[model samples]
Target: MAQKKIGSVHDLQTILQISQALTAERDLDRLLWLIISACSRLVDADRSSLFIVDQSRDELWTKVAEQTTTIRLPMGSGIAGTVAKEGQTLNIVDAYQDQRFNPIVDHKSGYRTKSVLCMPLINSSGEVVGVIETINKKNGKAFTARDEQLLGALCSHAAIALDNARLLRQDLAHQSLLHELELAHSIQQGLLPQSAPSISGWTFAIYQSPCEQTGGDYHDFIPHAHCQAVDVVVGDVSGHGVSAALLMSTARAFLRALDQDSTRPGQLLEQINHLLVQDMADDRFMTMVVCRLDESGHVRYASAGHEPPIVFRTENGYCDENVETDLLLGMLDGVGYAEYVLPPLNRGDLLVLCTDGVFEAVSPHTGEVWGMERLRELVRKQASVGASALCQKIMESISDYTDHSPQKDDITLLIAEKT
Candidate 1:
C-alpha cells in the first residue's frame, strides 16, 4: 500500500513519536540512523542521508543512508557539504539543473536525481555540526516550504540528542579515571610509615604533604643496634603522582634493607644507590639525605644531591650546614658517598630536614619561592619550641607564604631534636 501524505494531523502525531524516540536514544549510530529515517518519513522523501562534520579533518562523512556504504567529502564540495559549511537550508526544485548537485552519486547507485532539501544541523552554540539531505519527494514534486519546515524542526531535536550523548560519554570516562586515581592514592598512603619511632635522648616530628592524591616524597626512621641510635631518611623522587609514588616505595624498601647491614650513613646510601640504579628507569632518580644520631647526640649524615639539613643552636641561633653531596641516587652504579660527622649536639639543639617542595614553594600572587633564607629565619624563631610545635609552625609559615596556591610537588619534613 502507498503511504499517506505527510501533511495531515496523523503526520504531526508521527513526528511527535519520532522526536520521543530520538531523545531516548543514547547510542550515537542508532540516533543518527533514526534522525535520517524520521526526517525522510516526515517529508515523504524517497531517501535521506545524514552527514556529520569532522572538524579535525575538515570533512563531511556519512554511513547511514541507502545506496551509500560510506562517503567522505571536503567541506563545501557538494550540496550536503555546502549546506554544512554555509549553515543554510537549501530547497532545490530540480537537482540536475543546479550546478551544486553532483551527478557522480546517481551514476554510481543507478538512481535518477530530481530534487533535494538540504539543511545544516546546528548545535546549541549556533555552530554547524552536520547536514541532513533528503532526496526525491515520493509524489514526483519538488520539496515544498512545508516539507522544509518539518525536516528542519526534526533536525533541531536530532542535534540536541547527539550532543547530549557525546557529553554523557565524556563524563562517564572522567568519573572512571577519578575513581582509579583515588584507589591508587589509598594504596600509596598505606605504604608510608604509620608513626614515628621512639629513640632514646631524642624527640622526632614529621610532616608529609603531596600535591595530588599520590606523591613521591618519603621519610622513615630505622633503629640501629638495640635502639642505641636511630637512622632517619628523607627522599624526594623526580616527579609526582602514581609513578613517582611507586619509585619512592622502591627506594624506601632498598634503603631499609641496606640499613640492616650498615649503620654508617655514607655506606648505606652508597649501597642503596647501587640497587636503585639497576631497578629504576633511565630518566628516574631521587634526591635523598640520611642521618644517624646516637644517644650521646653524635650526628653522622650524608647527602645525595638533596638540600642540606639546617641546625638551630639554642645559643648560636640558626646555621644551614651546607654539607657536600654526591650524585643523586639511581644516576650511576657504584657511586661513592661522603659522610660528615657534626660536633655532638648539645641539649635543646634542633635539626631540620626537608624536601625541595618546602624551600621552593611558589607564592600565588608574587611568584616568589619560600627560599632557604626565609626557612632559616623561621627555624631560628622557633628553635626554643618543642619539636612537634616547631614542625607545625614551619608548615604554617609555608602555607602563609604560598597563600593557598596549589601545591606543585610532594613535601616531606623531618625534625630531630636533642632532649
Candidate 2:
C-alpha cells in the first residue's frame, strides 16, 4: 500500500504523535528504537539504522533498530562517519557513487546500496552521540528539504532523550555512593562519646563535618573513674576518600587506647604520633587537639598541628584562642608532641573545635574561606546561645557563604560550653 504523503498539517498528525512518544520514553535503548522507527516511517525510507559513536573503539556501533543486519562503520571511513565528523547532514543520492561511501556494510548485509540521508546525532554538550541513516526514499523518489525538516525535528527530540538518560544514570550512581558513605558516617558517629562525660559543673559539645560522604575528623570526651580528668580529642587526616576515612578509624582506635592510660596528654599524643609516622602513607597526615577536662572544667590540652579552639567569653563579646597547636600527625617519624593548660572556663563561655573544612568553606562568588576571624564573630554572636543553636548558626552561615555550591570538602563542628 502506498503511504499517504506528509504534505499538510492534517497529514502531520502521525508526526506529532511520534514526537510525543519519543519524548515520553525514558529507557535509553527503547527510546533509540522509537526515534529511528519514526524517522523511517516519516520519510518512507526502506531502512533506518542508528550508528552510535564509540569513543573507545573509534567506531560507530549500530546499537538499535536494524532494518536488515547489524551495521558498524569506522569513524572517518564512510558516509555515516563523515556526516558525524563534519557535524552535518549528507544526502547521498547515490551512495555507491560517493568515494567516502564504504561498501563494507552493504557487503556484510548483502543489501544493494542506493541512497542515504544521514544526520549526526548530537547531545546537549554538542558531542556526537551517534548518527541516523535512512535509505531509499519511497516511490524511488529522492528525499527533499521537507524530509530533512521533519528528520531535524525528530533528531532534536532524540538529543534531549539521550541527554536525559545520561544524566539519570549519573544521578543514580551518585545517590548509591552517597548511601554507602552515609552508612560509614553513621557508624563513626556512633563511636563518638555520647552526651559528654557527666562531670559536675562542666559542659561540652562536638562539631564535625566530613568533606565527602565520610571524613577524617575525630573528637571525643572520656570520663575518668579515679581522677577529675576527662580525655578529649579532635583530629583531621590529610585528604578525602575511603582510604582517608579508614586511616581516621585507625587513629581513633589508637586514641581510645591512650585514653585508657592514666598518663600525661603530651606523652599520649607523642606515642600515637610515633606509631602513625612509621607507617602512614606518603600523602597521609593528621592534625589533632587532645585535652583533659576535670570536674571543675580545668582543661589541660595539647596539639599536633591542629587548629586552635576558639573560646567565647560571656564577660564581653570576645573570643580567645585556648592554645597553640603543632604540626599534623603521621607526617614524619619520631616527631615530638605535648600537652598544655587552659584556665578554668566560667559558665556562659563557649568552646568551638573544628577541622579545616570549617575555615576552608568558600564563598561561592569570592572563592575565599570563611576564615578564623569570621568563625570567632559567629561564636561571639552566639555567646548567649545554647550549644545546639551555636552549632546550627555556624552551619547556616557556612551554607549561606558557599551559596549552596556542592560541598567541596567535609564539614565538622564541635562545641563545648560551661553552664
- Ten residues in a row with the worst lDDT in model 1? 1-10
Q: Pick the candidate with the highest lDDT.
A: 1
**Clashing residue pairs in candidate 1 (N, C-alpha, C atoms within 3 angstroms):** none
* Cα RMSD for candidates in order: 4.8, 6.5
Query: Per-residue lDDT for 130-173 in model 2, tens only?
Result: 88889988768778887888787778778777778767777888
Cα lDDT for residue 91, model 2? 82
lDDT of each: 0.87, 0.78
Candidate 1 lDDT over 248-351, as tens digits, reads 98998888778978858999888889889988899999999998889999888899999877888886775756667888999999899999878788899988
Report the number of the highest-TM-score candidate.
1
Regions of model 1 farther than 4 Å from truth: 1-8, 26-119, 130-150, 225-228, 256-263, 267-284, 332-334
The Cα error of candidate 1 at residue 230, in Å, is 3.5
